[model samples]
Target: MRQRLAFALGYLRNPRHVGAIAPASRALAQAILAEVLRNDAQVLIEVGAGTGAITRALMPALDRLDRFLVIERDPGFARMLSAHFPELEVLNCCASSVDQLPLDASAPVTLVSSLPLLSMPKAEVQKCVSAMLSLMTHRPGSKLIQYTYAAPHLRPFANIPYGWRWRRVVSIWANLPPATVWSLEQTPRGASIVH
Candidate 1:
């Protein structure tokens, strides 16, 4: 109850930064993070990590010594994140500037974003996603995961030429307004040609 109240107050105070009123459920967050861990992604990038609810769930799912990078535009939340997860690399930056992230292309990266894409201007959201995709390692099995309360089919970047296949992985009704998980897989051109 305390956590929910804190999240509600946080969201009310800053809707743009908080994004959602309630943090994702532990079960749902774990399920999403598990998929990233399963892919053995060397680097994990989290955008809009408000209050680090997902971050809390993510840490246990990750390998003992994996590198996790979190980006939060809200200075207060960024400080909270830093205090909560001191070991992680927390950047007080926006998702749209994802390309500026200090990551290595030699390693595969899995981006987990909680940004409210449905609320943002389409062009801005597209730019951020595009930048993140560009930074991703083009390895055959690399992918990204995004969660939203809106319908999966209504996603703005559905037709983008990012060579990614977006699929709805799971839906959690137990959450405040319920949420859906969207997984993006980068399909190789050769494989697409064959199919």
Candidate 2:
């Protein structure tokens, strides 16, 4: 509780850096990360991994051979993440600069972001999303999982090209304000959007 309050206060003071008030609940964090792992994505990029609520759940789901890249802008949180999950390659950088990170091109990338997209400017949000999509190797089943405290359809990735489709995997009312997990998939050319 104290940590959550501190996070909230920090965010209130600096909205751009401290995206969200509280860390995700264990159940919601696990559920969100599980959707990405279920698709067998070899490389996973986690954005805004504040204090590593989802990171903790993500590590166990991945195999020893798999790689996890965690991007966090807050140095304090990044240091905490490094201390907690030394196995992961934690990058103290913004999500928009994801492409600049040293990632393995051979592996399929699946981006899972907890960044508060709605709170940020549209341009910044689009850039971050685009960067994530561009980083993917574009295999048969590459995906991006994003969780938000809003209705699934309401939070549109509008800047994304029509070739991509978003699906609501699950919703967790157990979370503080409740959150919906949305999976972004690239549809085949000329194929209808997948619900």
Which 10 residues in a row give candidate 2 its minimum summed lDDT?
A: 152-161
What local lDDT score does residue 152 receive in model 1, on the 0 to 100 scale?
Answer: 45
21-131, model 2: which lDDT tens digit per residue? 577899898797668657777778889888787888887766843778899888877888888888889999889998777756556677888888877777888888778
Model 2 stretches with alpha carbons more than 4 Å out? 1-6, 137-140, 188-191
lDDT of each: 0.76, 0.77
lDDT for 165 (candidate 2): 80
Q: Which digits, one per residue and each the tens of the lDDT, describe model 1 over residues 4-116?
A: 77678778777765667688888778778777776777778888888788999888755643678999877877888999899899999879888776656567778888888
Cα RMSD, each candidate: 2.8, 2.4
Winning model by TM-score:
2
Task: Estimate the lDDT of model 2.
Answer: 0.77
Worst 10 residues of 1 by lDDT: 186-195
Name the lDDT value of residue 118 in candidate 2: 76
